[model samples]
Target: MKATATMVLFPELQSENDTIASQLLLLPQNITKNPCENDRTCNKDSVNINVVWLDSTSHSHFYRSMPKTVQILRDIKESGSLNVFSYNLMQSLKGGTYVNTVAFTSGKIFSRSYLQSKKRGIGNLFNLFQNGGYHVSMIDDLCWTWSAANCACGIPTFMGVKTQSWISEVVLGKRVTIPELWGNFSKELKLRGLNDIGASLANCEIMKANGITDPFFTGKSKVAICYNGLYQTDYLMSSLELLQSQLNRANRPHFSYLDINLGHESTGRRIQTLDVSLAKFMSFLGRQNNTLTFMFGDHGNKYGTFVQKSKESKIEMAHPVLFVLASNDVATKLGRDWMRALDINQNRLVNILDLRQTVLSLAPNVDVESFPINAKYDNHPNGLFHPISRKRSCDSMGIAPEAGKCICYQGRVLQRVSNQTGVVVLANFALGELNNKIQEQFLAANGNESSGFGNCRYLIGSWITNVQQTVSQNITITEMDIHIPAGTGAPQSEDVFSVTIQVGSNIPALSTNIKLVHHERISTYAVYDDCRDVGVDGDLCVCSATPTLQSWHIDPPTIFGYISTVINLTRYLYIYERRTPHGLNLETSCDSADKTFEVVMRITSKVNVGYSKKYPLTFKVKHGTIFFIDVFYQLNPKLNWDVKYDVDFKQL
Candidate 1:
């Protein structure tokens, strides 16, 4: 046998004069019979979930005219079935202010129906629920339905007076009944005793005393409903805590439903302000194995107001209500089936009205289809109906079909500035002998003395020197100087050389018009060598050669046509002399000699002066056997590499 389930219907904006009265008329008939014959329990099923529509209209006069509804609620509670209570309460804050303004301005001109209906409905609902005997309760109040039309004009003004009077009567143990302002319309508007306000508080205390803390009241005779009122942050926080605490204490499964009206400023802000509270509550619900919960908005509100004021008939205000239901154990067993049935894409036109049916379907021994509304209900057809999809009219503007790409709605456009300009091409190459050989080969083959390294070289060569090298052994001396002899016929003096080894490289081809005055001076030298023969007994040798300049000025006379000689040599000779008769015999032989040479050369290179170019000849040196030369240039009046560009708006 299946366990009994409960259903609660909480409706906001249900008027007592017409809507409420008609719904109440239909409830007794609906509750008496089982509409579905397939299920045997349908015939004998008890009402697990009860529906209580709060009549907030009577709040101002609840002490006098709330007996009927109160009696009805108590009678339902005595049946040992679940009581599902649902209703909206007056937003004492917003409604009261609006009501007072209208009453004061219109005086006796305003129809009494507006205030009378609201007062009666709210007063009756509150009285019924407060006195109703239900283990669980859901109050749908100011959280949803924030329109001023739903509230009384004198709410703010009358609530304080009424609350005090009600409290006094409660303390005095008096039956504090609201005045019958509608029919009799002749109740004295006098202040009540202190005991009236105390009585109301006493009722609250009594309700709290009987209230079960279980949020998911899975047992029989439990009540769950929604509250409709303007929910402030503090109120919501307290409400959630109360619900959570009740669920924790009840030790039985229960569910609490809340309508998050995102369109209501206070309600929306309440959720946002206390977001963590809601999260904690949801997490608690999720962990309860026996609980099933649902949250959603009844309908969307207008953009500027809580009420729909536009005259145009559009579905924008009616489409796509958000629905979320969560359960642990039940979901684990029948989650897929339930999801399939509830899936928006399955073409089910489920709306606020379907809430009752869904809850009834989950109840034990209840046939959801037996209800007339559920029986005649044709599920929304495929493609035409979806839970998450809503059809909106396309604009008639010239914008493209795919112009807007927003998931929710269009937002403000953000303007941005373009920071990209011309492309900067960078070609990185090895900085050692390999790159030097490539550059030297290109220069020697394309040398043009007059046209500035000619067109083959776009920019002068620059050196990134004093680079720290990583090696185990140092084979060469720490510092070595290369000297260039001066003038044509002058004997090449090794000591008095024209060019001084100024710590670093001197390459003129790199100089540009923008950087003609500045030059870099080398501070130190760094060297690296491969330890090829670590344990070998022979001396390690390295060879290098380069050309030098005879003078600082360009086109100077060539000295000895650039002499190349073996610059370095180290000999290791062996001396062996036999002792005896041959007197002293000496034989000496030397090992292979290490050699190096320097050669001077003049090359033409191009220098860029902003947008223009000029030809210049630069002096450089080349290695003898290595067949590579590294050229480094110094610029005059240091150049600023910051490039700027202009874009034509017309082109855009």
Candidate 2:
């Protein structure tokens, strides 16, 4: 009963000898290539711009934690540093935790697939500058993965390797077995005319007697930034002093980016005392000509001294420092109206991507201000590097509140509701009507929880305070015992903790309705054998590595036993006491992801435990991309190139 079109009746669809001419006529009108000819500022000739970018890692909220970083910033403010700008609460393009993602891709659509394509090129700046005839070189104490074949470097090797490492270190208590160098970049640079001036470790010695090892000059077209101090220096002060010295050496009328890895990532955990040294550098640079400077923190110290404070205080850990200064000449170049516009945006928000947009404006060929704000996306064309409205929300800037670490409360404060919506404790009489004393303790206990807190989940230090309202009413008391982990010796090893609470209606209660209520919060951490490398730049403890307790809340911290079982009990024992990992950790809150894991765990263990197993189980289909691993792993070119999908969840 099938019909076939084997006859010549469909001859109109056939190709003719002049098909080339016909094909050109069928081209789509909307798509075009490099369509910037119409802009008055779009000049096809070579650009005239110079830049010195100093890329630092970590040290968020430096202004609050390190007065020295601020003093230097203040000095820059008095100098040619730009205005205080923000990435508008944006996280790194690769991931939320920031360390693993591309350290510098802003305003670009990011996803695993998108990243695979962009991975060949480390950053947009490199390409933009190189095309504009600039020689770019990075001088740092750390080796940057810019323009290489690895994640840290821009190389297009399999991400599975890093994904495995990311999972093993964070989710499971496994060693960092991923290979740091997978495959060599096909060429020295992904694009022609770029250079990896290999200046790291002690190679800064190369730049000692003379300048960079190679001639870092070519027709005055050069963009280079260097980091002097290091987190590994005997004293952080020594490094800061070194950094101050380096800042004094930038005697050019170019845009310079400086990143001091002080207040280093969680690993250094070192107290930063940089005010005096930074002040000297800033003061000196403030008097320079046609210079622009910026001072900011990458992120708060991951496991710094103040990480365990209240939610408000912990927020500072997420909010990094940001200050900008610029010279008079540079101000005039940006235009006087741009300067006046800054007045209207006194307290606007910012993020890293916005920084990207601002930097893009520096390229004279791409005239960003020629167009209005993106009508569809709501982003300002000029970005924060110029002027942004004070009322700009994270949405307008394309930075989500959670990802950008935005702390604006926006009037969402907590208060008591009516008794019908509050109140109640059972008559078990164990805790006696859940009086004000216990409620006050939990409220003031920095929430004493994180995930499922609204439903009264208990985590040791997460700060949960929303349920105090219902505590005032007569409520029934409920009780539950915490399961303690077991192992004991001169070094005790057991994960056990206990908790009791009252349960009732109208109050947040961790009742049995939840999907999976169990112990163990899976956390990802950049642990290292040399505890010193804990929070170093690149977040890769791949060098001297060890398995660390992934939990940030653990005071002394937990790490795996380096020795074999029972060989050296004390050696393997956790330095800190155990808090039953029984509460809801943020990573485990993905209900669907949890279900997937639980099923996988069941199927694997079922056979070993003599239980009937459904090797191929039927699961409900969600209205989104449901990937089968085989499709991605086999390197199906057609699928890999075209089958990518993005899932956007809408909040109720």
**Against the true structure, whose TM-score is highest?**
2
Clashes in candidate 1: how many? 90
Deviation of model 1 at 473, angstroms: 96
User: Cα miss at 6, model 2 (Å)?
Assistant: 72
Per-residue accuracy of model 1 over 221-329 as CA lDDT, tens digit each: 0232212222232233344445444433433222332322223221112223224434455444334444444433322222221111221101222232232333334
Question: For candidate 2, lDDT tens digit of each residue in 377-422?
Answer: 3456665545665555533544332232333433223233221221
User: What TM-score against the true fold does each predicted structure earn?
Assistant: 0.28, 0.46
Error of 2 at 412 (Å): 4.3
Off by over 4 Å in 2: 1-60, 72-106, 109-121, 144-257, 267-280, 369-377, 385-387, 395-404, 411-524, 528-652
Error of 2 at 118 (Å): 8.5
What 10-residue stretch in candidate 1 is worst by lDDT?
Answer: 421-430
